[model samples]
Target chain A: MGLIQRVIEAAGIATIGISIVREYAEQVQPPRTVFLKWPFGHPVGEPHNRAQQRAVVEESLRLLYEIDTPGTIVDLPFAWRRHDYSAWDQPAS
Target chain B: MGISRWKNQLLALLATRFPALAKKFTDSYTPRASTGDIPWVRPAVPLHRAKLALVTTAGIHHPEQQPFDMQDANGDPSYRAVDGDRLFDNFTITHDYYNHSDAGKDPNIIFPLDRLKELVAEGKLGSLAATHYSFMGHIDGQHIDTLIRKTAVEIAEKLRQDQVDIVLLTPG
Candidate 1:
């Protein structure tokens, strides 16, 4: 996924990736990434968790604009199945 | 399912349940270390005014589309172009490398098209590109070259032609 992100970014479009595996993101070093400590196949969040999903999307998009350093991977603060996403608000742009 | 496919599925389930086991699996597969300068680009527009697109490695596709090849030890480098408007109406996930039962129930966990739509409706985002791209994430061996050199490049061109201002990539 990071490799593909690199290609797309090199093509001149900004790219941000949601990575469940931090090692892969570190190795491939895509321009911008948000690392979630969730299980594989659930990078955004758990199934049907609307607030969780929206929060992840909002954070990634926010980082897309905020991350200026290349190869920056922001570790998201949500805990899997533990964090309360109901109060998760969109990050202020 | 073939023997290898079944084995992969079992492994995926175990990995999902055990983070330590997942780390071992990731440690086994070494992605190509990116050299030289890491690619960089700023968003052409702000989030609320930018045309966004999704590019995922979740192995999702329309049911009528051919499933990703599971026979190869090296994963498929091919991509499926998905229509954003109608994707959730009918879709299929073809990845053996992840336990997709959860994703199968609600693909928003991986693709999040519905969540993005809500953002658009709320004026939090500009709009979504009509088309999105999907690929299987477990590419290895010679297929990595194909992905970097051919398929990824092709998708980048397609995104450019679509006038996407930013891309959000998700993985399986």
Candidate 2:
């Protein structure tokens, strides 16, 4: 997270970040952030689940609304599925 | 700071110092390239609370372009080229491993444009960019360095053209 924040920061852009695990990001402090409870990969939602994806996007955007003060952080209301492997990792046959 | 923390730190030292094939191993953990500690090589557009864009690297294939070869994806798909200008109105999520793929490859996992539209309805954001971006997720940096940088430029240009204020990378 530090390296990415550095790269994005170096690009001269202010960034807002979201992460399932945000301890490292919190320590490093990107410009802004939103914390999510989902697993590492499905930050938005499950694969092929467009509706859930939209919800995630909406929540992430809301984070931008509060960025005016700078260094603002928000916690999202969404939760992650408990089951493992709702989809497959290997390419389909 | 704690006993467990110290133990974990010791383990990391031992692993790095006395791995079975220490010579064969390289310090693969690279930070994003930088001339120094300045961070990004180029500046991203200022993110205002306005219309935003989403980009994904889930190996999404447009109906018009060649489909992602599963066989190739399993191994040396690093040679594949990114077609940044291509428009993909229709796409499908391929593997479930997007949570673990590189940001450049499976961007959609992080930036879900389809979801952004819904948020607009819910008043979470102002709007979505007219067009989003996608690319192959499995390319090796060595093989696709030029393509990745070019695509970033192209994406930034597109976002600027679209008047997007923010880009949300979801990585799911």
Interface RMSD of each: 2.4, 8.7
Winning candidate number (DockQ)? 1
Instruction: Enumerate the candidates' DockQ scores in order.
Output: 0.70, 0.18
Residues A1-93, model 1: lDDT tens digits: 999999999999999999988889999999999999889889988888888998899889989999989999999999977988877654433
Compared with the true structure, what per-residue lDDT tens digits does model 2 show for residues B1-172? 4564355335434433454422222232222332333332222332234665554444454455565443432212321123333433443434322323332343444555434444466554566666665444434444344344554555555556666566554332
Give the per-residue Cα lDDT of candidate 2 at B23: 24
**TM-score, model 1 to reference:** 0.97
TM-score of chain B of each: 0.97, 0.51
* Every candidate's lDDT: 0.92, 0.45
Report the C-alpha lDDT of model 1 over B43-65, residue by residue, as the tens digit.
98889999999999999999999
For candidate 1 chain B, the 10 contiguous residues with the lowest summed lDDT are B23-32
Q: Which runs of model 2 end up more than 4 angstroms from their true locations? A: A1-17, A20-37, A47-55, A67-93, B1-49, B67-90, B94-96, B99-111, B122-124, B138-140
Instruction: Estimate the Cα RMSD of every predicted model relative to the unseen true structure.
Output: 2.0, 11.7
Which stretches in model 1 have alpha-carbon errors above 4 Å? A89-93
